[model samples]
Target: MVTLRNAGLSLTPRNIDTQSLSLISWNTDGFSSRPVSRASLILDHILEGPKSPDIIFLQEVTPFVRAFLLKDARVRAAFLATDAEDQTGLFEDVPFLTMTLVSSERFADSLHSQKQGQGVQGGEDCMLGRVARVTLPSKYKRDALCVDVVSPTAPGAFFRLINVHLDSLGDTLHYRAQQIEILANVLHEPGCSGGIIAGDFNAISPEDDGLIDKNGLVDA
Candidate 1:
């Protein structure tokens, strides 16, 4: 494993051989309002090493941020969803970066089998995207981001990758839970077999009793 530290944060990259497939997921804490200085800091961290991740699942990024990152030749591909909008009329201009990536051909084909629908009651407008060097065959397409990845050592076995950003904010727990259930159902449906789900869950760590702190606070 390779470890790098920056801005008081440390990231350890697991040394899975090049032959092994890998995926990365992270939440950018609402990329819309992040200052350029902070953004640059993050960009530096992402670009610092010889390592380039095959798939990245990022949440809370604006269109501007997405465009900035895409400018890097190493990015290869990207996707974004439309949930960054707010109901209170605030942040009308921030771009939903992840949604844009989902529009790409590589990501769309994987989700072809699933039903396409609009924003769920409590869930953020969510979408998925995928990127790789080779073009995935048409028949394997789905409405969600899907990609065909093959490990030379393990030829026949393939996996689908998914990115999801569940709901956050007040009274959204029920909505988030429902969304998770829906996702589970989709996974169980015929043809949608096993795959990796990545993205910001917006969930707090469980407490000592292993119970989620639904109240959003810890006892003092």
Candidate 2:
């Protein structure tokens, strides 16, 4: 039995006055018997409830669940998703993938005017790009889904918002570590203002502590 965990990551740069960026990540077990229903319940609570977030990251999303999320009235109106494209060629062999949804309202007109390189009220051109998968060595064919979103706090600055589902179980601890290292390198790339990585780590060993810590990441 897998436990579902919803994690929150807060972005706060010291000394700079910036509004809070609320983000939520959850691993929706797409293999479950009622994937769509389970996903709907989670969406209803997160989107309609008081804690409506600025960004939503979902992992283990199947084609069926992804379709429901994209077509949902509220989600379509409120968020711009990364998995809107036909992923058959890219994800045909993969049973599930990850997705990132950015709030259209929060990014202002940038999302709609992305092609023109228009600015959001507080920044230069801001846009949310398509998901880029980082292949990981694992029997499960796991990968990290990365989205580049303009930083709300820093004008013209962007951060790699990654939705990752690491290789599971205790035996794959080394694989998980390698996955984190690959992601950490992306965070430090030129022109990037760091990043926020979130998803199901499937931690089951004492060694799991170093997987994140050695990569200079903190649990949020």
**What's the CA RMSD for each of the models?**
12.4, 4.6
lDDT per residue for candidate 2 within 1-220, as digits (tens), equals 0111367756653212454567888888988999999999989878876767888989889988988998999988888776475455656788888887877766543333333434335233244533466788876888877766655445455666777888887788888888878878877776566667788888888898766778777666
Assess candidate 1 and give its lDDT.
0.38
Candidate whose lDDT is highest? 2
Give the Cα-based TM-score of candidate 1 against the true structure: 0.51
lDDT, candidate 2, equals 0.71
Model 1 lDDT tens row, 21-126: 3345555655445644565566567547665443455656555565555564444343323232222422354334232233232233332232343111111211
TM-score of each: 0.51, 0.82
